[model samples]
Target: MKTKRFSLRTLLLTAVLTVVLTAGVLLGAAWLLLGRAGVSMAETMVLINTLFVGEHDIQTATDQALDSLITGLGDRWSYYMDADSYQQQIQRRSNSYVGIGVTVTYLEEGVLHIEAVTAGGPAETAGLQAGEEITAVDGTALTAENISEATSLIQGEEGTQVTLTVRGTDGTEREVTVTRSQIDESPAEGELLSDGTGLVTIRNFNSRCAEDAIAAVDSLVEQGAQRLVFDVRNNGGGYVSELTDLLDHLLPEGTIFRQRSNFGWETTVTSDAQCVELPMAVLVNGNTYSAAEFFAAQLQEMDWGVIVGEPTFGKGFSQQTFPLASGGAVNLSTARYFTGEGVSLIGTGLTLDQEVALTEEQAAALSAGTLDPSEDPQLQAAIELLRETEEPS
Candidate 1:
């Protein structure tokens, strides 16, 4: 006799389980937000009533709940674009969205920090600068949940207008009116270092990034680059395929990674023929994540090179995009990935061989030329790693 097919109840339980484990919400508003699609509060209470009967089976009920909810939405990207997805999107595209172009992030103080103002964009055109506090957008309080929504609200068709209520670093608050328009985001930037080390900062990994990076590397190599410092600072991450193709040039032909799903199934992604075996150092910090971590992990795993600076942001889950009838998508973590050496960088990030920390004052000092990159602990450590492994010219 064969086993019976999974029921809708089972599907909903699976979804609930996935959401609870992934988001770690046990109850209250967070739980309501997570399971609002299908499982009503009453239904949840009913399931809780059965907790005693379903001991080990509680997980099945939760997963099934989540499955039912997800199936109803029918969206692929609309489910929840977690931090990892946000990082990937930012680093994958060079084309800036149309809006009062400003990079805003939540700081430790719970205030919206004006991280960057793209030059020539509406925000900069309206005199918006970095280090300002965005208090509100059209009078709505700015919060982490609404940050993306506010940005989207500001972005509109070309020739649109947006008013921002911002408080400067001096605690002065005011409203500024600005028109929205297209802003360009550059992907690949390269500079020649003093020691003939080509320093390339690939801000994103969009389409054609592999070619762009190769060209940049070739230009640096031609410029007498004996070593390379690939700076991915503040880089969130992007296309896994793009990163894999890039690693093809940086890692030897072999299994680079493995992806395991909820069902305990595994798939391996291997490297291509071409590989770069130069003296290289990858710079990562608390923000270097997703595909960035992927590159760093494999490089460190194979002992091909060194990963310096600080621990990575550690986003090891893989999302599968499913399209919805509403022209939206739901991108959920369908699988977890590991390095060739079985290192998990999920909640735990990549451990750099050399650890370094930076103070605000030190960063300012470095920016003002009082400190040097060669003297910066992180850079110095990376240089030392590269020098120690250098090949005789």
Candidate 2:
């Protein structure tokens, strides 16, 4: 009697397994048929996941599939970020975080190059200089595929230490250990020049950038500044909302820019009643991009300022970040923005009223904060133009 009962139980389990297998096959076939009938990509993904087999984490698989789909679009500006990376991006735009502060760029040759080091940050305190190459983090090799992972390893709770192997421009390597700490970024910096010009250098349009710029201008005015010079050299740009707010303060009431979405929807952004009525000159370079480029273009179009330096790095499209259910996010280029003159700065950047290219030596000196304004041809040209306006005709 016991043997008969055991055989019956085995038969029941076999029948259940067979039914599951058959159901999976049917679901897969249905998915194929729906694809042929022109089903949406989202629906197709759901069908594929419903019939997936073998050992796998469903969430991870879904994330990978979504990443693949976005990659297939062939849009360089659109990308998917994991949960951790998404959070880090948010922190960066907010201009604060806990990490060894350094901005890095991953080269096509798989080298991790330090682009900029924050003043007074842990990276700067550890004697890590810009233009150096980072070879490894905590002894693990750095590669294009692992750059984000390496960054994650470098960041940790405050008071944690991260060891990095760095290579100098001359190929000498050294290991440096840096401690993580909270960083509050001051994006806009101001100074009153000797010639009574207010020099407001906007590093990027991060959070509170507009407020900082206003305060900077106000302080410089109180110090007897007769003119303003807005420098955005090497500024890669940040939040668009912040950019618009900055423009609202600097430009008179008029059309600022027009945004056209993928679905043919359009929206026009106009300046508010508030404005800064001051003689201004904007300084830009090859690295001035996105919102920075727009800032220059708007001033040039309105005849509000004289634009100097090299042509900007053109990038007119604006990306919107969509948060995923898995805590990750995707930044997709949702719209292409055009200037008030109905010109798009996508491939061809903004044309400067006066062009001045900085030599390599001068650029290095400028980065080191040792470039004399009298020796800086671009700045000198701007100062001369502003001073000319001050003279009686």
Candidate 3:
């Protein structure tokens, strides 16, 4: 899964540094119509253009202006994306993208580590595996400061091949050429463990995600797994409607969530009386965000499941991406959301039934899909709790 784009985090933490491509023109318009503040800004631009010691690009300056304009809003959820990035975001929403299909994390040394290799993706087909290092993209060796730039270089027009210098887990290094294709990633996966435990990993909440997750749950039940565990770790969230549908499938008739805007208006999403009521648990980590976090919070709030793992840094607002004529776009936080209990999850996050923090080695193994249940404290605890708690009478 190519997690994180410019985040499902609608892919979130990758910040967009550039802004409205037409800001240069917008600046002139602002200068013409506005009063003293606009004049001051225009004066600064003029001074920089004439007297600056170094090369001063007016386009870059205008981009900075628009970027700063959004930053001034003081909302971390709001961000700007250039044209290409915005387009990638749209593709990701449809559960597809043009890339080699690997999820990466930056090491402390500024190196890129491949945490996941999408099954059957270009990277996987090219022999890339999890727990390896993408030392370089093409000939540009990855460095700490160049992580973002390196990632950008890895993405290109579909069908173009990108050379990746990969370091295997055995410590041997080799260069692998992977064709960048349109990787259509599945949003969910399911497995029935030997213990009759159904594991449904909902990687995202995007297009058709609920349908897939529901299918997985049903398949697991057909396999005779009475208890279930839903994995939403590292999930960045997606469409609220999808989240609502999934919640409705698992939870009984009730309010799934509530959306409130700054304008004092509110909207509520409710579920019917029908639901899947198996003894359940939601597995999470710090990267579990937005709709994913809300999914866990709702389950915990309604006593539908036990929330296991670390608490999420709470977020109350939901964002919507607005595209610009210049091909760029801005993802703005449009409304604050609440759990079904009508409470904000903006502080310590959802109540944890059991907080299981994995050791460094364990975390790495889990990321690489090598962590066995015996070695996974979170999974073991969740399964144990499900078995001992018994189904609700």
TM-score for every candidate vs. truth? 0.70, 0.82, 0.83
Model 2 alpha-carbon drift over 4 Å, by segment: 1-60, 262-265, 272-274, 364-374
Q: For model 2, how does the per-residue alpha-carbon lDDT over 263-328 read when each residue is reduced to its tens digit?
A: 999888899878877789989998898898899888889988888999876898899999998999
lDDT against the true structure, per candidate, is 0.70, 0.85, 0.86
The digit string of per-residue lDDT tens for model 1 on 1-393 reads 997599889999999999988666455655566566334645765768765564465544544454565656653322533333443354336455556777776754435677777667788889987778877777777776666455556656778787788888788999998898777666566778787777767666666666677778778878888888777766777677777777777788888888899899998888876776578888788777777778777887887767887776678787666544333345676888888767788667887888887787655443332446666777677877898888775
Error of 1 at 43 (Å): 11
After best superposition, candidate 2 residue 41: deviation in angstroms? 4.6
Candidate 3: worst-modelled 10 consecutive residues by lDDT: 10-19
lDDT of candidate model 1 versus the reference: 0.70
Give stretches of model 1 more than 4 Å off: 1-95, 107-111, 139-148, 206-208, 263-265, 361-376, 391-393
Clashing pairs in 3: 7-10, 7-11, 7-12, 8-11, 9-12
Give me the overall lDDT of model 2: 0.85
Number of the top TM-score candidate: 3
